[model samples]
Target: MENRNRFPHPLFYLFPLYAIGLYFLVLGVINAYVFLAPISIAALMTMILLPVVRKFENWKINRFLSTFLATCLALSLYLSMFVVISLQANSIYENWDTVSGRVQNTVQKVQESISGISGVSPDKQLEILNIPPSALSSDSTNAVNSQKSEKDSTSKKGETKESTAKQNSGVKAAITNFLDFVGYSLLTFIYIFFFLFYRTKIRLSIVRFFPENQRDKTNKILNGSLSIAKQYLVGRLILIFFLWIIYSVGMAVSGIDSPILISLIAAALSLIPYVGTVIGYVIAMMMAVVSGGETGQYIGVSITYGLAQFVETYILEPFVVGDKVDLNPLVTIIVVVLGGLVWGVVGMVISIPLFGMLKILADQVTVLKPLGYFLGQDDMGSKDDDFLGAIAKKLKRMFK
Candidate 1:
């Protein structure tokens, strides 16, 4: 009888190696699409439009009209969200000076108390705090004396002012850099509109890759991948909305300072995986201290964060996402942390989808099925063994 266990085809090993090489070879070109972001507006529109397109097909509407209506409806919904968030942000900005002063005074008082406990004099505290001597007093006489002393002290002190000004200039420059990034994102969204509008054409082109007999398999894979991408995007949005509601409500009911801002901060941090809540907690507590001028509220904010994370990790994620993502928690965390380290916010946003795509492709490739096993969520028995340990135990038994 023929051996029931068949070795992998000769091409399998070579194909995987070649595929990996090709990935790197075109990584730069691929990164353009992979990192392309729709305007949050255009992205929102795309999500809404996709469903409309499906619904139109169900109703037997003309294909082009269905796509057009979907796109238009999405644009409308996106505009509404834009108006809301923009208005809220602008309202916050209108009272920026008052809010800044309140927060600063609140922090100064906390610093004073902590300095006293640490047995540091106010002068020393100012030095340690690295604030200008001018900030140490409100009285004009003392302020003038401090200024005179600062001038007499050292020319090096004058250098500090120049350094501070340069730092401020650098920040202004960075803002311009960020505007350029937004311009790129807008360009990306324009591309998204065309891709979405003519999605059928893209799929048809991909279909030409495979031989006739294998075309159906290729199409199934294409559809499956698209569905996965859509789910991740929409599901993540759902997760963000739920977090905003729960966090805002908790902060508000607890009488935390700037409950609205706390909620927004939480929503933003929640985008970063594993450690985002910790970062958000620090921010919320700092805001709470300034807003309330109370240590108790600071502690309360921290506790609230701990509770929210507990609920999010144990309750919300499991139930809402339903383990469809199926990433190994360790790998998921490492990927997210690495992404954050590499590219900050943009990296965090793209990491999971990139990871998911890799794992999904691994599952499909015969030679790379082992890689899927390595990255899978299930502990599902592994092939690793310790030969030395086994040999030592066997020798001990023989001696016995």
Candidate 2:
């Protein structure tokens, strides 16, 4: 009788505070991501390569040397992949004139096909859409004339040749991005080396955050998180390889050019749930279009993608990746999109495993168990399910 309702439950009060704190903490992290991205990436890479470092350590190698060797091996493997892709890309670029002409011809055919469906030629459709056909023709003519005049003026001026403004801008941007990437990669390697060397101290530091009484639980959670992260990474690598083989064979059989390269790219893009598949399909479709394949070839590529995705989703992911993360469909989609918004594609690729680690910790902590459950793959009675059940019960009672 003494205002029991006003007092409510302790959890009812504390839960809100915990949730609010976590929200702000995440917001702060996202805001500071630019400064912290290197550290985060390094930590993730270290976790992935820690086993190799430990294996070397077990063989009585120096930790410093072991860490360096592990880092170098990982880097070399990735560099090899990059080199292969670069060679293929260079080959494509070297034949860009032919490729571009083929692409333009294919695109024109597509426009014609589209126009057929509307019973109007592409030019008539453009006119209907308030785009003058003559305007487009004039623009193309003007572009050609300008290029001729520019060459004449340059020859007259006896000046050294220079790339067009667009080409120069593209080259400058590409160089800038490449330099930034190299710098960040070096920083990440340094971080990985130190992280491997001080791995024990790092674990102890994390354990120290908890009370002495809870140190064991904290240690267990951390160790479990690391194991799960490693497992997830390995599973992803296997899945990528599997998809690559399947896709490459199919594309090659269908006579797609650069089958291996296209398959490798498409398989890698399968990391992000739902969205990645769409993007990969569009990319393959574009490649097929540009490769000058007939309609049958396009259908073959689409069918190949569809089958590979079906197997990947149903067989590979569930069985190979397993249920370690246990994230629900809704949570996975939301986390992927949020990761993309915060850190672009890299975020999307790494977000799931990181969230899985968070889910593991949440499950270990009593106050956060509900959040862990919510993020889980369980199909228990959700809020809407409960509401519907309640309404059904009320209707039954009224009828009775």
Candidate 3:
């Protein structure tokens, strides 16, 4: 009777089946990511751009033309940024000699400093690093010998054919990849247009999936999810623009080379949340070091990053983004890492908003309210009157 009682719950028997189904679901998602990613991205893009399309519609523009114009505008902006970044990258490549010299100087200075502190001679340091002392010397004799060897190698007909074949193969592969990217982008835009054009129909179809009694609740959840996603994404875009301006001005003042490129990259990386910020800082510092920046320049970089963080956390986020996502820090980090593991960078970028939508759904369902609560920010009770909270309140008051 005790054994019978222990096995009384049907859920126990179903537990293994549930686990197996979940495992397979995850596997399927990972395997089918190439097809699924575009659809998912289109859904998010539709949410973000729906307002623009609506405005055009109000202006008496048809849905088809409105969607096309919005999508083209987005594509144009992206392409413009890409072109500018590419130009900056080309400039860097053209001056590679100067950059390489600066990098070598920085490395030598560091080695000398290490030798002074560790009582190791510079020559011994080089030996320890597996570098010959002559490696740093720009002796013309070594350059001439390398040129001669290259000429001799090219003089061999077989070697020339082999080199040409490798170059041809490489070029072919690059062209193929570019064509694939173009095709995927075209498909994504098509999906976005359809999603926006038929959004009402789509919503009704989704609602119909639920029982008659629950349809209203399901529709509400859908609207709430869309609102949350739209707000979060739009807020992020505004924040990134501000960050780009701040980073560019600060880094330029600090005498960093290629300030625009560095700032653009750092601002873009800000999309990945906490981890991206640290990575951006590291990249900026490395660029500073490569540019042979002095102590004051290093101090300037540190101050710029600190100021940016302060503004983003206290001022911008509070005023702009608010608690749209409402996800706790622990859950945010976990989902972001899991997303990176599953679908890499794109997954990481979209994870927060997707999870935010899930939280909205969970909150509406009685059985899932506990999971929603677990994913949400803590109330903090009396701690609401704490230091950060007070600052947040003051900011909201001043801004509003």
TM-score for all models, in order of appearance = 0.72, 0.82, 0.89
TM-score between model 3 and native: 0.89
- Badly placed stretches (over 4 Å) of model 1 are 1-49, 76-81, 135-182, 380-400
As for TM-score, the candidate ahead, 1 or 3, is: 3
For residue 118, what is the lDDT in candidate 2? 69
Q: Per-residue error at 380 for model 2, in Å?
A: 5.3
Task: Encode model 2's per-residue lDDT on 1-400: one tens digit a residue.
Answer: 6686577789998999999999998899788876678888888888889989989989999998999999999789878888878887887888887777777677568668888886788877676789755443545767765767554886644543344666788999999999998888788888988998899999888888889999888888998899888888878888999999999998888877788888889888888878888898888888888788488779989889988976786567765687667788899999999999888887898889899999999999999999999988777446555654465446547656
lDDT of 3 at 23: 95
Per-residue lDDT tens digits for candidate 3, residues 165-228, read 9999999999999898788788888898889888889988888889999888988999899999
The local lDDT score (0 to 100) that residue 212 gets in candidate 2 is: 97
The prediction achieving the highest TM-score against the true structure is: 3
- Superposition error at 100 for model 1 (Å): 3.2
Show model 3 residue runs off by greater than 4 Å: 4-8, 121-173, 380-389
Spell out the clash pairs found in candidate 3. none
